[model samples]
Target: MAAILTSLRNTVIAGFVLSLVLILMFLNWGGTLDYNFCAFLVRWLHVISGVMWIGLLWYFNFVQIPNMPSIPDDQKPAVSKVIAPAALFWFRWGAMSTIVFGIILAWQNGYLLDAYTLGAAEGFSVHKNIAIGIGMWLGTIMWFNVWFVIWPNQKIALGIVDAPADAKPKAGRTAMLFSRVNTMLSVPMLFAMVSAQNIY
Candidate 1:
């Protein structure tokens, strides 16, 4: 247990092993591997990826960005050159995984078009569809910002890509502002997602 706990990869593997054990203990394998079960698994994966994505996003907004100014200039390179890049790698990939799995979940549940269209296929009559549609759209927009806007600008701001020195400050500010925009949208997006679950 100690050895597993000391290594992140082992710890994650152990967690999945435990989950599998619990599933096997509680469910009969013969009846459980059906469409609904697969759908539930996809939903679970979607949720886990989303937690990774949003957790890092909040960490940046609520912790790192707000506290950066207090750090001395000499030590700032530790964050800029090392920690920020590592965190951004996970952040961007988490966003990608989240969006991919979310779309798969939506498709598996047979609401891809309805939710995307915000229930327009059914004449806007389904409240749940509308709710999830809003969440999906917001999440998609956030994903887009993370990839196309934030990541490119971050590469410049972090000096992973060469840019004119004057351009760095502008790139950093753009990334920060867009991150803030995503943070603002996150609350409502989460609300819509949760509301969809209970709207029926």
Candidate 2:
């Protein structure tokens, strides 16, 4: 019992199982779960994952990369070997999850195409549609970079999985440059998303 509780994976799995049981109990007790509840859940998932993704992006740009030059050569591997790989794991998955949940939320509300097309009716308002469209586009680009460019490069750079030794430096620089590009776009992407709720 104590051993199970002490394991990080076991603890997380137990918590999830407990939460699932509670949700099932609520459903059995005639607590109606509606479309709104599902939408809320999807939105919550989006927000949580977005925070994790962007938080690590900031950490990389604002904290780790900026401080790298100052660290001694002997200490640098600790950051590259240990901290980076862990952070990258969360960062890439968070980006993927955020996009997935955002799509699910939009699809559930029957606005996935409408939002993508910037509101596709004569009576529709353009403000919210445009805002959400920009966010969606930006998120899509960021997701592409995460999976295709950044993650592949980072795997090489950190030696998580290897490539030619000569590839490491180039891969690392490419990942950092793309990350910086994403960081610059994130500000407007967030603005567009938040503004979509009210600006219309």
RMSD in order of candidates: 1.3, 3.2
Top TM-score hit: 1
How far residue 36's Cα lies from its native spot in candidate 2, in Å, is 0.9
TM-score of each: 0.96, 0.83
After superposition, the stretches of candidate 2 with alpha carbons farther than 4 Å from their true spots are: 1-31, 120-125
Model 2, 113-141: lDDT tens per residue? 87777676635566787688888889889
| Per-model CA lDDT versus the true structure | 0.94, 0.88
> What value of lDDT does candidate 2 attain over all alpha carbons?
0.88
- Give the range of the ten consecutive residues with the poorest summed lDDT in model 1: 25-34
What tens-digit string does per-residue lDDT give for candidate 1 at 33-96? 7789888888889899999999999999999999999999999999999999999999999999
List residue ranges in candidate 1 displaced over 4 A.
28-31
Q: How accurate is candidate 1 locally (lDDT)?
A: 0.94
- Backbone clash count, each prediction separately: 0, 0
